[model samples]
Target chain A: MTTNHNRLTIHEAHKLLKSKELSSVELTKATLERIHNLEPKVHAFTTITDELALRQAQKADEFIAAGNSNPLTGIPVLVKDNMCTKGILTTCSSKMLENFVPPYDATVVERLNGRGAVIIGKSNMDEFAMGSSTENSALFTTHNPWELSRVPGGSSGGSAAAVAAGEAIYALGSDTGGSIRQPAGFCSVTGLKPTYGRVSRYGLVAFASSLDQIGPLTQDVTDCALVLNAIAGYDTRDSTSAPQPTPDYTQCLTADIKGLKIGVPKEYFVEGIQPEVAAAIRAAITRLEELGASIEWEVSLAHTPYALAVYYIIAPSEASANLARYDGVKYGFSYSDTKNMWQAMEKTREHGFGAEVKRRIMLGTYALSAGYYDAWYLKAQKVRTLIRREFDQAFTKYDALITPTSPTVPFKIGEKMDDPLQMYLSDVCTIPVNIAGLPAISIPAGFADGLPIGMQIIGKPFAEETILKIAYAFQQATDWHMRKPNI
Target chain B: MKLSREEVLHITRLARLGLTEAEVDRLSEQLSNILEHFEVLQQADTTDVPPTAQSIDLLNVLKGDEVAASLPQSQVLVNAPRREGDFFRVRAVLE
Candidate 1:
């Protein structure tokens, strides 16, 4: 019961729960025990709701008994700490909100609760989702389950690591700049960044409003589709949410990609990519071709090289505006040892935020400052327009683009921490999709030196089904997704 | 691209952040280095391209002006660091 129940995927658990062969309470307990056992090593969660989970599981069992079950019913899932959960801590792994609990849930949490999904806990992340590694988390760093010494790629590192380690059946992660996909790649999990506005961001603590997107990190592609069906749709609460209709994503998961056109962007396969990682992705491309995806090798998005520069300017600029709410008045951390109101506010932020958070805030303030606003912020946004236009042009010629999710596999914990520039470059492959507002999925492709590698499939705006179909087909022919770390 | 100490201090003031001398010194150097990376943007030709504040095309989404249920004052003040009855307590703003 202990070993078997915790390892079951959402799809597998759904079958067991529906058949009455395994009760949700039993499943929840087993999962909770696994989380407790692994918490010391992985440090995946900021808060574990074992009591809340049991109560929710009991309700889920009653719902299942009444034949009112859904795909996520009775499923134990973890959420990244950035999303608010009513009466639960939503810290964003920052000291600024370390003791903060919200009075309302994020829209995604509400939807998951509506589906009878048992909330396991809030996972850790970089402070305000600013860095590429979980090392910036004010709480603690989440280690890659595959190798404890190596860092799990982040700021969604805790979500990816939890799913990989079977701490939760699946978890929700937000991607601003490759936060979801890069960590999913590092941990060998299946992750998707839905098209911008596909999911509501109403109660998500904003990092960069335009680029931030909430998506799933799961064990396999089928589970990804099932979770997407439960969460994706228009929300009147989030004005930016698309008014387009949400389809049953499960219908698009057929393991058949006969005539799909897949483009390989040359810019993604640049000089910095690890040799084995490139070879693994190239091999996956060949496999897709064998399974009937026509691969075009010479695709070029000329503006790709400038995405990093554009993202740094644009994300921080938006973040500076979005983060001004922590002013020591309404909620979260406050500093009392100050002379006046202004001094109190200033000291609150200075002491509450971590180094990376402060760096981004300073960078943003500088970029958006009066004299330099046009030269830095405005220029980056215009370049962003060019970058988006390039992806728009590429999508017209091909159904979707394929690339390596990250340039390399997971690195040792302290390897890239000292150099911020070096750490930012780790996400080079996955950043452009967010810049263009496209849907992208990262799936397990292969392994190098016992570490996992991932391949990314990016689709047109509101074209999640197309990318899911391709990823589903590729996942069917590979055994990489089936392999688990011996942790 | 190098930001002088005065420039860093000026930016911090605008950002409303209080920092120690050590942080100020380290940040001036680090911020300058990151800015050096942004120099590449000047090379790109974006003559007539408009700045994209958001990627999605939706604009001016209007809804009926209906008052929705609001959180109770107690619930809203539950996480406040300091509160006086219904109002949040803070250092004196008006001298």
Candidate 2:
């Protein structure tokens, strides 16, 4: 049951499963063994579905024995806790829903399981997906598999960490702002924040309904494409889910980047970028240029500076409404006997949420409140429009935008815990994509002082295939994604 | 402008969180720091800009009203922390 240190990619895993070289049970057991060994140090899982996973694997084996084969038949994948999995504990890394078990599977989870992919467990995340670092997780902080002392960037921290630590072959992560990409960068894996509606968010615990997206975190772009093929489609359950045709993402993997236009925003390369991170990103762009991809400099996203402010306002505003459902009466944790219903709700929320989650809820409530609605919420939305317009203009001229996934490498835990603003700024480069509802992916570009750095590839709405193609091209040119953490 | 203790408590209440005086004191400072950082938004010339809620230009995805399967009430409340009959139970609202 030991994980093959040289585990095959999802594409290769499917090939082996079809050829009868590997059984789903064996793959699931290997991943479970890896989780048992590494999860203590990495804190990647909020709940490991060991028993349930074995049952699913057995079922998958039965299907294969019956000569039924699908794209993801017998593959094991992890899901972020934020995405509800029916009959499993779906705590969003918050005490508020510490005991809540969802009654229905998230759209992506249903799709994954429908394709016969075994759900390994629920991964940890920021409380309600509100923080940049998983350190804000009320349940447990997911540590970077590379360096245990550092954070796996969040709120998809556990998914990124688990995949990087080889605990799971691939995982589903929900990205609002940089949740998926930042953690993917820190963990040295590949993660895609598919176009906002590319993957359905029907049962995902909402952080910001408008900005949140569900995507795959995997070992490589090819695996990402495979997972995307399984998960991305129109779902009637999610009204916002796009009705556009889903492309075969793998088809673009072998496409040459001979004439692809890659835009490098001068605003992203400003003075504050960490030297090592900037150097690694610059090296990646240079490598792309060497591969015959034309690099365009001086492309401007003039609203870049306001993206953080706009996101903070808009996300929180949506979060305020989204999180209101956890009133301690419907499900999960509730306070002990209290004087009245109001007191019970107040006590439960007060005790349930961690600091960062409470801060955002407060900011959001205030922004959406009567007096400040026009001044803050409305104003932020207007700026959000401008930001989207800017991206639209840029995309008209360039195929995709490129930037450092994060401003700096993963900082020590607790270094910026007291400064929430500083932590929010960590997502400065990655937020605009979510704001614009475009597709974005983070791939391991290179290393900075032994820590991994990620290069972000952003594409137009519903252009997830293009982003994956670009990432696949970059990955083929480098060995970064293949480099595993010593842990 | 720095946030007052009263404003901090009001915000916490609006967020449905009960904060102790000590927590309020600490949060006031943290909230003030974050607000100060956002002060730059005040200078943004959004005078005539229209508010943008969605990224895509598409809007109003309407569907025909159709019957959908509803979860059994028992299963829906299966995970409720406290339940009574078919409804989720809570602390008594009235004295």
Candidate 3:
């Protein structure tokens, strides 16, 4: 048994399991022990399923003994708390669902289990996946594994932190607006936000139904592809799930990007981007060019600047409707102190939700309210069309677009907590991809002041295979993905 | 684009949230700042452009009417905060 089995990637673990060189039980135990030691410093998980994981690992070992093991068969993974897990406490880091044990598994979780993946625990996230930093979590903040004082970028902060800290081999995170990629960038891991509708969102707790996507955060581009292959596909339960057939993602990870046309959007290199991050991204693009991929410097996405504004309006409006279901009756927190139903519901929300949740609810409510609906929600929707059209046009001339995943490196834990707009601005480069319902990946580009920077590759809708090929090639050319935090 | 205290209160009521005076005051300022940032949308020319509620080309998805196994009542009601006899219980809506 390898003592450092916790540091093994899914591909490495699979090889050991298949060759009878290691058992899933040993790998799972190593991972759980690492998680136990690091939880105090990282605060990465909301709930740890040690027993469930051991049981699943035992089953996976049996599968491997029978020579039926797959890539993720014996690998332990962490799930972001927003996804439902049968009989497991699936809190979205809000007091509202803090004790909410789901009755069934999310489609992605079901898919993971079907592939014999052992789920270790549920990682914390921003309350309702609403904030850029996990500081907004009602439970606790997840620290960046690289720097304890800095935030693991959110709302998928905990998942990214765990993967970086070697607490789990990989993790699943839902990205509404850069939730997965931003944190991955901060933590220096590889994260991919699959094209909208590429992965089923059936049991994912809704923040904004149209914008939310479930994706993988992994140690490398290949592991990201492996996790994606397991989770990506259509389901009848999710009406928006694309009916398109999923390709064997692992086959797309060929370390070759010859003759590929890549574009660098001038809009993403806006004024607020830190010079170090900009330089790292430029270096990454130059590397891609050296890899024989054609690079375009003059590509323009004219409506890119308006994505943040459009996202705030549209996401909140949809959230106001999606979150209305938490009415103290159905399946979450409730207040029974009052006799009147209305007062009880109001008090439930007041006590159950954190400040950021209330702020977003209010913002969404105001946007969708009668008089302001057209000005805010409808106008944002129109602008959303323009943003989508821009990507559509860009895809015509280029196979993919590259940008810095986060404008700045990981910030201090509480730096932007009080200033929502400043927090929102950090997602400027990533929000446009969600608005366009496109696929994007964030890979370790370089580092600045000891913190990691990520370069994002955006692809056309339903073109995950194309982006994965590009990311795999870049990752092969650079050794950044192999760097680990000292935590 | 600053919002009034009354407007903030109205939004809270519409959203079914109760807040302390301090929370309301804080939110009024914070929300106003966010809304002010959103004013950039005014500069966008969306004239004659169709609104996109969904990004992909998905219409009504029809499933067969055949009966399938559903969650048992005991399992479905397990997570309810207040329940009685397989039904989620809520406070009285009328006097």
Candidate 1: tens digits of C-alpha lDDT, residues A7-64:
7989999999999999899999999999999999999999999999999999999999
Provide fnat values for all models in the order shown.
Answer: 0.89, 0.75, 0.93
What RMSD value applies to candidate 2? 1.4
Off by over 4 Å in 3: none
Q: Tens digit of lDDT per residue, candidate 2, span A1-487?
A: 2457235678888887888888888888888888898878999999999999999999998998888978688888889998888999999988888888898888888888888888889999998888878988888788898898999999899999999988888889989999999999989999999988888889998889889999989999988998889888898888888899988888999848899998999899886789889889989989988988999977888888988889988998899888888788788788877768887888888898888877888788878887889878998898888888899899898899999999898888888887788888899989988889999999998887789899999998888877787888888889999999998
The order of the candidates by DockQ, greatest first, is: 3, 1, 2
Deviating ranges (above 4 Å) for candidate 1: none
lDDT of 1 at A99: 92
- DockQ versus reference, model 2: 0.75
lDDT string for model 3 (A163-237, tens) is: 999999999999999999999999999999999999999999999999999999999989998999899998999
Range of the 10 consecutive residues with the lowest summed lDDT in candidate 2 chain B: B34-43
In terms of lDDT, the poorest run of 10 residues in model 2 chain A is A1-10
- Candidate scoring better on lDDT of 2 and 3: 3
DockQ of each: 0.86, 0.75, 0.89
Q: Candidate 3, TM-score vs. the true structure?
A: 0.99
